[model samples]
Target: MSLIGKEIGEFKVQSFVNNEFKEVTKEGVLGKWAVFFFYPADFTFVCPTELEDLADKYEDFKKIGCEIYSVSCDTHFVHKAWHDVSKTIKKIQYPMLADPTGTLARDFDVMIEENGLAERGSFIINPEGKIVAYEVIAGNVGRNADELFRRVQASQFVAEHGDEVCPAKWKPGAETLKPSLNLVGLL
Candidate 1:
């Protein structure tokens, strides 16, 4: 089943941030927007690039009241090790979540049971803790933070203006379509 519009469940896990281990929890994120970014594992190919890309745009997300969380089955130690070794990862200011037991992977339905790894998944959760949007991609393909940022803006716009719908390639200032009987057969 699709996770869109579904409320997030309670969870707490260790995370690496600012050269220290911290605990991140669903409860703590309540009333705040969050981006849960799930990847296969740490110290692997492609993951760092994706993370660094997100890191570069993290301030934009933060400006929009969204906290980015990069999750993997790797432990907090592994996350720290990767951050220490990878110059790209070292630039990250977001939390590096550790999902060693695959609880998060299972919850997000991104677990690769056979390999004990997770597929690439990205979820945008609103302030109410409900998932507003999500995307799951193949392991080989990476995601774009700019696109995701735009999606977050769209979601927020729609939430504030329930009568309007964002059109293709919608940006913050773009015009929105209002559903009406008069427009039924127009577009």
Candidate 2:
């Protein structure tokens, strides 16, 4: 049941970005690197901090040709209101996707049926719209964008060099292991 290598399904939602509202679809995520961050609610305690951290690293993500999308069950109007009132969230230039109907959460399989909210989910997708990495955690736990950036780099390295695989704690310009029978049981 792993979502790895699974293409994003059809789903469209309202997104608030750059003081405007727009519709985002599964097709919209194609042809570019993207991150889908799912959180419980907008005005909660930990969400803003995590979002601000991502915002701080937004430019670095962009440098790697990645786009960030923050999703919640809240409506787009709520996203706008939070964007207006919260200075930390206001720093986010990425789109805030509104999933009031829980469709996106369900599509990502992070929805809590009883709570009508989503868990802390982080998904890294490649240019072809396939999910490359994903993590879902409890609502209280936050995520690190720097780690996500590293994962993205590692994914890109692996994609471009299919013969090579990134080792633990791999960074760009670092050494990658070539998978071959001769190297088996040597490490």
Candidate 3:
């Protein structure tokens, strides 16, 4: 039941962006890549740092045609309130999704029932709405936005060059392995 390689464009979600509520779903992600990040809640310690990091890298993500959405179980009102109070949150230009029902978090399989919050999960979905990559970390750990950027670049490279596959620690302009019988055991 792993969501890997599965398409998730069918699920509709409400996201708070720039102090407004809007619908973001498969259709909204039709023409660009998406980074769907799930944090536990608003006004939390580690969450704010992670979110601020993502905000700092927002322009870079946008340059790659990716839309970022940070989701939590809190309502849009709560998100707005936090944005108003926190200078770190006020710098965020991307959408903050309200998953009060936990439906979206459940769909992404990041919801924790005991704590009633989401795990630190991140999904990199392609423009076609297929989930290309995903990572779920423990609640206490913060995610690396730079690594997320690298992953997106690698995925895009692989998609564009169908015959090549990126190796570990592959960055843009790095060598990619071609899948062939002759290449087996060559490395």
lDDT of 1: 0.92
Candidate 3: which stretches are off by over 4 Å? 182-187
Writing each residue's lDDT as its tens digit, candidate 1 over 51-148 gives 99999999999998889999999999999998899899999999999999999989988999999999999999999999988999999998999999
- Model 2: residues >4 Å from true position, as ranges? 182-187
Q: Model 1: runs farther than 4 Å from truth?
A: 181-187
List the candidates' TM-scores in order.
Answer: 0.95, 0.95, 0.93
Q: lDDT of each model, Cα atoms only?
A: 0.92, 0.92, 0.90
Worst 10 residues of 1 by lDDT: 178-187
Candidate 1 vs 3: which has more TM-score: 1
Counting only residues 3 or more apart in sequence or on different chains, how many pairs clash (N, Cα, C under 3 Å) in candidate 1? 0
**CA RMSD (A), model 2:** 2.0
